[model samples]
Target: MVLPHRLSPMVSAFTALWKQRASLKTLILGDFTQNYLASYLGFAWAVLGPLVMIGVMTAVFQFGFRAGTTGSAGIPFPLWLACGMVPWQYMAEGFVTGAGAITAYRFLVRKAVFRMGYLPAIRLLAGSIIHGILLIFLVVLLFCYGASPSWHWLQVVYYFCCMFLLLLGAAWCSAAVSVFIPDIVSVISIGVNLGFWLTPIFWNLSMLPENWQIVMQLNPAHYIVQGYRDSLVEHRWLWDRPLLAHVVFFIWLFAALFIGAQIFKKLRPHFADVL
Candidate 1:
């Protein structure tokens, strides 16, 4: 059967990524080596960068602001903050870097044989490498806080997939657009910084009034952050959340993916000229 012309680029992009998975792995590793080659600490920065950020935030909020354990579960504020911050750092880095994936690899874009589509995925996967390490740190923190492993802990995989897909969609769109308008990268950086506070990473939803809580839940990041807390701290299953929460998150996720694909498809032909 033939795919519709409109869907061909999207289907082909995914198919090519799978076929070239080996090359993708090589490119991702190359990025890691190139990134830290100049630093004395080398690849360790991947782990230390986030750990330092989380440590400072924990200090400022848990100690300076005296923001006690914010969740209803009474998990240590530092642990709760780490759970949210770990996944968030992954998303934030993916957004900022993925937006520039096209321009960053213009040489590949110029080559007729290479697919520019892989650039965004390369950025995302590279960030995932670091994300996995941070997750280990989060698990150790959880153990230190006396939190026992539970079946709910498996939901971290679900939430990680959720974030990856959401970021991929957003990356596809932002990356394609940034090729033409370089300013989009700075715009994304600003948005991610603002999103850090707006998404309730350090704060709990219960602190808000019922109506405000409903409004805040519409932000998809809220679902992922809260999902992390649920999996690691609260021991609640995905179904334990209100139905509306699930619906809102998937709606945003799918919408982002569909729209991002369409935009990337339309703008893809022009990438070579612009870049």
Candidate 2:
């Protein structure tokens, strides 16, 4: 027989894991089904959506957003934009979806013990799969358009891991707050909008003046977007030395996960009641 104390966390974790397995699987299947349900081309829309956006950004920026800088990047402007868009989309969608994890399934939270944790995990997984598919499509498109990967492509794996950890930490915090104040979801919506503008999406950071560049460094997404462009387009390794800023980000992520879990546990009792 197993000891109660020894098996407690494992048992709790496992029960929650099993509860979510079906929901998570269903989420993936449902997303794929619904995403393509109305389209004449079905799943082709996934590829087409990003490609179309890539085309629009390229055209508008190449014409309207022109700066004096050139050749700072190794890839074409469209390919460079695609590289940034693919990962940034993942991060944004993951956080937005994760933020409402608790509110989405109010019934389960009211009835279950460990199930709350799985909601965010499932949302993250769903976003991850979508992002992964988009990345693969981008790679194939780039290759077809004559963009070849060097040893730097090897760094994609590392960048992906970084993005995952960052998402996990951020998602936990967002989900935690969502349980207490449903308005957190709205706040996140506005925040993501601001984040998109703050981030170097259509334009390169080099285009910014020196003082503004220093300010942009404070945004975690900035480094991450730059990291993706570096690894995929620039073919560089993950940052070699951890800077002071990165250290601060790592600390924030850790703190968010730790504090968020406790907050989730604390508020979990009332989730069902509120819902």
Candidate 3:
């Protein structure tokens, strides 16, 4: 049973987790040290990783697929690709990192002050630090591409928050489930790889026939990819998106949040038992 609180389970979990804010921040910092600081490549991996991924994909699209992603009249393929790539990497990292939170910190599973629910948030925090660095790199890239500074570029903040909400909601579910099922790590690994292709990061939806284009819009990541392009490439405001797109995106997001939160709350009490 969920704790005896009249507040919504999500609200309760969040509030409890908030009280441990310092520990959460410290843990996330330690995660950075643990993951990268001791390594030879060190912090350089953050920039190199995205650059290499882009290089590999660009090679494929240019040669393998002969795909011309010249990007909306002015943006060019590289800038367009960066916008979609950074946010998608954020979400993908959030899933993998958050899913492993519980097991990685199994020793703290029994600690009273360690509100287990904060595990996902802690992981997300670590990932976001790297994402923020990437965003700066993207800005430099855009300038180099001669994509003049525009106010629409600010809309990336809104899209980042949207992606954060979606990731957190999904993370809760993944973290909780993975605690009881170790195989979930592998499942999430495979799933993210599959999702990367399904998401419209590498290819443009406009490449598809009109009928299939409508269906592609249904993929929740499409909203984010388009939103990033809107901010950087298309120069469209968030409100300028079609009403149907807005409705569909929010519905998809909230469904993930609602379902994930319920699963998380139901399983939270059992976390220590399993770990």
Model 1 regions lying over 4 Å from their true place: 1-8
RMSD for each model, in Å, please? 1.8, 4.5, 2.9
Tens digit of per-residue lDDT, candidate 2, span 1-275: 56455334334643666766876688656655654555778667655776788788888877677622332534577777888888788778777888887777666775644466777776777667677788888789678778777787777777677776677666767887787788888888888888888898767777789999878877778777777777776765666634765776667655655566556666666777677
Model number with the top lDDT? 1
Pairs of residues at least 3 apart in sequence or in different chains that clash in candidate 1: none
Error of 3 at 132 (Å): 0.9
The order by descending lDDT is 1, 3, 2
| TM-score, prediction 3 | 0.91
Provide the clash count, candidate 1: 0
C-alpha TM-scores of all predictions: 0.93, 0.80, 0.91
lDDT of 1 by residue, 173-257 (tens): 9999998899999999999999998888877778899999899999999999999988988888999999999999999997888
Query: Which residue pairs overlap in candidate 2's backbone?
Result: 110-272
Which of the predicted structures, 1 or 2, would earn the higher TM-score when compared with the native? 1
Worst 10 residues of 3 by lDDT: 1-10
Runs in model 3 with CA error above 4 Å? 1-7, 63-69
Q: Which candidate number maximizes TM-score? A: 1
Candidate with the larger TM-score of 2 and 3: 3
